[model samples]
Target: MTAVQGLEGKMMNKYGYGTDYYGYRKKFVVLVPSTNTAVESEYHLMKPTGVALATRACVIPSIKVTNEEEFVGLVKAIGDATEQGLKDALSCEPDHVIFGYSAETFWDGKERSDREFKRYNDIAQAVGGCNITFGAQAIQDALACYPGVKKIAVISPYMPVGDNMVIKFLEDIGYEVTAIKGHCSPGAVEIAHEPFGKTRELVQAVNSADCDLILQAGTNLHFAELAGSLEAELGKPVLAINTITFWHALRTNGIPDRIKGFGSLLSEH
Candidate 1:
């Protein structure tokens, strides 16, 4: 290796100086859509130690939409743009690549988010030859950590079609979705503009005794800010999808479970 490359190798080496370099605490990169905000928020909350993170934004000019046609077109465009963004983010040589946008690819009918995640992973792996995980996979792993959480309620800023896809994706993975409610977000930009207070209300509205856990879906919705508060008030686990996603991401990378102030999910898991 050249001088700079040798230095980089030493910096990234998990066991370079007789120190337990911590397995899984390597470089991570995220391909974020320009209009979305969840990935950065979740990354801050996790405060990954001994790991590096970088991001490349896809060509999402705005998340605002007035009609269905425009929204559909935006979603399709986001998926294509983000895939290309991931190809670029991989150039940083991340140990794992996170596709940090949701609802852009999650659709109803024959298509589903899981299929899209796998497809994205395939592309990322082919280009970068590294491990890959998406926000959905993290949510799935978080659900498994809470064995008693069989039924769940969701609050998101997604349209009905995108909402159905999330519900279906979770159900396909084996959880009983009890209640789900979301703002009629025509696109991701609108979701980003939603006030945090409104999201809290929606979260509490769907929370019920039947539901053991409450999920704040969508990476752009900024649910981690309320997870602990919601959990205290509702007396149940309020899992933000972004929070869970990062929690799982950290775990998959062998990072320790030490994040604080989010909820019992991240710290406890």
Candidate 2:
């Protein structure tokens, strides 16, 4: 061997690094509500190889659910907290940022939602100097997988106000919502504690042949695993917000690993 080959072989022989766990491809910064406990776990469950997820939480002190007024106030508070959380996440110098919360995604209508998304996008661009993913846009992209799907069954852990916002957004985007079943959970923390079995029941409650697909919102409800099973039984897509959001983040970053048991969006699309 030549002198350069001998030196390279000696260096290789003396030291070695183990296999890369994350492939060192891209780092993902995730933002969620402080009371949320499900986003991190679900994201990890479906995360593809070569991708790393780092999370930061927006503070939501308490949830007061007496009436619509309190609900509106809580949403505003969550929005404020999300802004701070986004700032914190951008400090990580991630390749991309993922918004793991869903309620704020649906505002008054499509125009308002688009404006809000642009605002968040601008902040992410300025701070992280990278692309960002939102749950609302992911859901819309997931729906595109089912070309003939015009009507859908919906389930959420939000109150009536939040549910209405979601419905309005979908309708404005040209999809008909056949039915929406809200758990009306007390607050963010409570929503995180919702049992997966209960979510399955909600799917059953809203599901019908009339609807083309089933969609579960509320990122903290833990529906990734259940979505796969429900899709098999119903013979249609059962998309959880977390699954689509993660899928979008990965695809937007050009990571196309097929993740199984989470639903077709990650596995097939």
C-alpha root-mean-square deviation, each candidate: 5.1, 5.4
Structural similarity to truth (TM-score) of each candidate: 0.84, 0.90
- Number of colliding residue pairs in each model: 2, 0
Instruction: Give me the runs in candidate 1 sitting further than 4 Å from their true place.
Output: 1-24, 109-111
lDDT on C-alpha atoms for all candidate structures: 0.73, 0.83
Collision pairs in model 2 = none
Write one digit per residue (lDDT tens) for candidate 2, span 121-202: 8999998798789878778788888899999889999888988998998998899999999888877678878887888788
Where does candidate 2 stray beyond 4 Å? Answer: 1-23
Q: Taking the tens digit of each residue's C-alpha lDDT, what string does model 1 give over 207-239?
A: 777999988777777778689777877778888
In TM-score terms, which candidate is top? 2
